[model samples]
Target: MSEAGDATVDRAHALDAVLLGGPRTLTLRDLAERSGLDLEQVRLYWRTLGLPHPDADEVAFTCRDGEALERLARLLHEDHLGSRTMISLTRALGHTSDRLALWQVEALVEDMATRRDLDDPAARRAVLDELADLAPVLETQLLHAYRRHLAAIASRYSVEFAAGQDVGGDPAALPLARAVGFADMVSFTRRTAGLGSTDLSDFVQRFETAARDVVTQCGGRVVKTIGDAVLFVADDVRTGAKVALELARVLGGDLDVERERGAGGLAEGARGVTPVRVGVVWGRVLSRFGDVFGPSVNVAARLTDIADPSTVLTDPATARLLVDTPGLLLEPLPARELEGIGTLAPVRVRTA
Candidate 1:
């Protein structure tokens, strides 16, 4: 083997030793036998964790791996969670951790590069040497964040879906009534056309931070971000309107708000980010796999497309729900045909 290949292998083993708490001392069969789980069960569990299944004869399992399998078994029997659910949970962990690991490493590389004025490869090499110390802190933070989020979810579900509070909600809905909305940047491509790496990163970060703050401040949940746009949800129409309007007003606001909130705005040394257009709809949506899906979501997206910059839009039905809402005005706009959604008479919403 080449000397470089040997060095790479050595580095990997060193990382594994630190993270796994010991050297690998067992194979697939050994783990299964030690955990008293069926061979196929262990294989499926490992595979579901976004890990490649090594050869059954390969000694690639460590004590920590074995302990993980044992814990899974205990969770299943003790909690009575079905195997399918456990597998799904395992997949979620694997999928999130895969991206999270790379994201953190890249962030570390950037920090090292910027601090030392080194090139990318040099900074990455330096980072690899320091990662053993950082891994434990990252692992602990991940666990802490996971537990906190899980508790928040439990609390939210208990209140929102209380025993018989609103399960059979509006529109013969999926569960509870929700306000789904989208706020997207205007002329996104033109605004971001020639931004350099650092400038673009700053531009995007500013928008995301502003958008998230807007949603949370107005009692809405940020579902996800799509580069130049944000998807959000609230428990009711009023809250949705508040989120959509605030998002448009905050992130994609007029020149005055932009100067107040984000001085540089859109791109550095470029024209500020133009006002955002928002679309909100009240309806039931399916929440699965960390995303929302339903006709309402689609309608909200369509509405945002047609909304005027720095304004909020919704369908007539959704607008009606907010008619009695205070400090808001809804105006009917000319109906337009949207693909898949057909003709929709949009209502423009503005703060009173």
Candidate 2:
């Protein structure tokens, strides 16, 4: 092997020791025997992590792997967890962590390349070199954040259950009452047309980061961000109204105070951020697989489609709920035909 190849292999071994809590000294068959699991069961568990399985004889499993499998087996035995539920839980962890790890690593690579003026391959090597030192810190932070978020979700559910707001039905059904909304950038394609990759990345990131700050400060949680839009949810209509109105004012440059602050040091090219139109509705929604659905979600999306830039359009139901909300002005728009939703009156919401 070439010297570079030898060096790469050495680095890989070092990483294996650090990350896997030991070298890859066990094959799949060995792991199965050690963990007291069948070969098919071992494969099933491995596949649930969204990872490709190695050959049965390949020495790719570590002691840590065996230990993890043993723990999982114990849980299954103790809790009598069904195969379906086990697979679902494993898949959720696998999917979420897979994307999250990729995003974090890529962000690190970008930071390395930008700060050190290294090329992509070099930056990747640098990241690998630093991973041994960085991995533990990152892992700790990840665990802490996950625990905090889980606690928050559980607390909210407990409160709702206590308040008699629980949706009684199939436990797996999606029938939570929520305030769902979408904010879409105006003329996104036109605004970003012909921009270079770097410029476009900055533009999108700036908008998303800023939008998230506003949403969080206004007591809303960002569900996800599409290419040119953000989906958000709040526990109630009032909080959702605050989120929608604040996003419009901040992103659309409607707030004189914010404008006076001069874009808060955003990139020069992105200083003139694109305006956004918002739509919100309060109704029962089906929360499934990290996303939301149902008629209310559909109505909010349709309202966003018809809304003008820098404005918030809300369904009449939500408007009625917020009729006496302080610091908000609601003007009822004429009944308009929306595809798949028939004619409905949407209220234009703004600062009082």
Candidate 3:
């Protein structure tokens, strides 16, 4: 390859390294070492681009540099931006807008409160103009942040639970009640890995949207989602059962659109769009850091493990609690053994 080609390759690799969690402020020396390019070669590209080279004393760089480097890396990776590129760019723009708005909001709030004595109407108008200018940008940022946060949450529930000696959380002592149970996605490992990040993002968003709608609609709160399963809590078992049923129905029915899109789409290919197994149980549990714990929580998880996709499974006790609620049918599952929890008979809530 020619000198230009080698230089391009070096920069490309450097950017990849940075994007994948390299130091924020990298010096030319560091780039030369990591990129296999001589210091002079790395310097040449910076000089050619008319960007400044901070002194070695100022070697630390910010995440902004890392982002810029990532952009450059992507440019070098492809002669033209493709679909993946567009998706990445869109996600990045959304993230950037969020960070910028957070910083801007702090500044605006500080200024608004501190400048009470600026009596000139023109100055006041300027402040109002600044706020007006920032309104849409800040609103977009908030919406994006909320959307991303929610997507991350729904994506957690699509998995099976495995107990390990791995790091565990410190238990808290507090006023406790038997909160609701939450079940995660059953085929999360296979499904999530097969989907691209953007698609994974979309899948998560759809799940959260549906889940939140049903939970709030039925007067329950979704405490949090953990790795493809959501943790929800209700004041009592009946409410929990109602919340669980609504979640399953919303998720199962919502797959229709993805089903029609095509066979290989996430909705269908993942064994049914929004088709998630649900488990509802009631027992004393502790809540902390947007998560619930205790034996009740574990049983709910295990029950979800036993649930078939598009179905809601509840412990026999939960079924008994809901026995009086009309139109909610329950059928016994064949005697089955579950990990962590022993031989059990769960009632599947049959849909009419």
Q: Score each candidate by Cα lDDT.
A: 0.82, 0.85, 0.63
Error of 3 at 40 (Å): 43
TM-score of 1: 0.87
True-vs-predicted CA distance for residue 108, candidate 3, Å: 20
The sequence of per-residue lDDT tens digits that candidate 2 reaches over residues 1-352 is 9886677678867986999898788888998888777999889888998999999999898889999888887777788888777777788888888988897888888888899999887888788888899899999999999999999899989988888886676686566889999999988888788887666866787788888888888989888999899999999899999999888877864233343555554333233466898999998887766788888888999998899998999988899999999999999999999999999999999898
| Residue-level lDDT tens digits of model 3 in 69-98 | 556545645566564554455455645555
Clashing pairs in 2: none
Point out the worst 10-residue segment of candidate 2 by lDDT. 263-272
For candidate 3, the C-alpha RMSD (Å) to the true structure equals 17.7
Better of 2 and 3 by lDDT: 2
Off by over 4 Å in 2: 1-9, 168-174, 253-272
Write down the TM-score of every candidate.
0.87, 0.88, 0.49
